[model samples]
Target: MAAILAAGAGLHPARNAAAAPMPRVAAAGWAGAQTLLALGVVPLALPEIARYRALVAEPPLPESVQELGLRSEPNLELLTALAPHLIVADAGSVTSPLARIAPVATFAPLRPGRRPAEAAREATLALAARLGRDAEAQSLIAAHEARLAGAAERLSGDRGGPLCLVSDAFGNRALVFGGNSLYQDVLDRVGLRNAFTGATSAWGHATVGLDQLAALDPTTRLVLLTSRVPDARTFLALRPLWRTLPFLREERVTVLADILFYGGLPSADRFARLLAERLAPGNAARG
Candidate 1:
């Protein structure tokens, strides 16, 4: 809760103003790394940089950036060795230990009660300010808005525009994203509607059985943010209800590669591009 409060005020103040330009920087959270990258600031270290490279192929981090292990539990020894002037972490992450090593600034894409999408934008701007890259940040934000608007224009003629559902599945459970999720904001930006009307947790997801898919509108389109292992199709095949779902039987399901669901503006931009490219409402409905 205190972390969320800290995030609401934009980035928490960096302790050492004398360390302007932050000669060496490191990010303890994936979202923070993405924000720094978007601002054209190459952090000296990032959590799971290798895995991040594989997951989000675009906008690669430099080879020099050291891997700081898991985002949740960063390698303190390796991180301290870097001797970074600043370290960025998520508002929800535990960063007390990092403060002892360097100045810590927190960013939160999902600030409590605030829309995740809006919070992401604010975080991006704040991050840019930290690095004295406000101009670059504004340009990036403008480009992002243009992309969203362009996607909406292209999908304007979509017949079932607002009846789309986005989710990720694992084993027998489905993590349906809607309501306060950042995806919902993207959907609205692109003139598409989220079909899930169920209650969501503060982070904006509801875990439900596959049978819940049957409860959605018959015309609803399902776009899956798929993972590599335990393919959704493999597990869904075991459930009779999965087969009975209209979207599945009619071949109206679109599977997209997993992107950072809780990342900053760069991720939002990636999501918009992926959704616009894969989502063809008229084409799917006709098929």
Candidate 2:
């Protein structure tokens, strides 16, 4: 069903309202927005949608979407003005106020130990049922699986050495996803093994000092860094000491797309495809 942009042009209604109830959706976070979009539902308004402008560069968003934010808080007045039937939000901080605005449905990040793809698949299916588009949800999952399979075939036998996924910076301090993270899920699908295979927490964000990283196995093949900070070159330049690390010495550092790494969703597929292009056989070897 085509989305209906309200007369104000800010609120987009679902054209399939008769077949599926046209509920106005408010996405509190980018991941939620992505999940909803993948389900063929466009939110009426989103507060943090603008935060993801850079993300669309590699994956691109549909032109029919619009965003509405009333500052840090979703404008309850604006939400009421749009007269939405449902609101989808993250289970984190913004839930209370968002629920006050309307009947809000909350979703959490994929927990540790759970398969990332399975969690994402289940969430998409549940969301589709909520939107009355179960068939569309199944189709999306199939397409995602097909894309992943194609990527896997293309990168077969080109698996790089064990890699570490890090976020944040300075080398003095960093956050790494050990074994149980959505990032790990992507790594697993792409046939890459994580270097730090210790016990991971339920949600999996382990902050450690650079000294710990320096002590890691010298054979570590590559490091994938994800951060909110822009100017990856500048970030790397600031960490001159990091160059002394074995991985860096071997010229095995790759800065990943922040959105695909941090944001929830199988959007990691985009990053996986990019990795395949860079690491596949016949590609230039690291310095």
- RMSD of each candidate? 4.0, 5.8
Supply every candidate's count of residue pairs whose N, Cα or C atoms clash at under 3 angstroms.
1, 1
Best by TM-score: 1
TM-score of each: 0.86, 0.82
* Model 1 pairs whose backbones collide: 162-193
Clashes of 2: 1
In model 1, the runs with Cα more than 4 Å from the true position are 1-22, 161-166, 229-241, 281-287
Candidate 1 residue lDDT tens string, 99-127 = 88886778787876888878888877776
Name the lDDT of candidate 2.
0.62
- Please give the TM-score that candidate 2 achieves against the real structure: 0.82
Question: Could you give candidate 2's per-residue lDDT for residues 171-272 as a string of tens digits?
Answer: 477777777777677777867777877666665558777777777777676545454444334555788767667777667766655544434455666667
lDDT of 2 at 61: 51
Instruction: Tell me, by lDDT, which candidate is best.
Output: 1
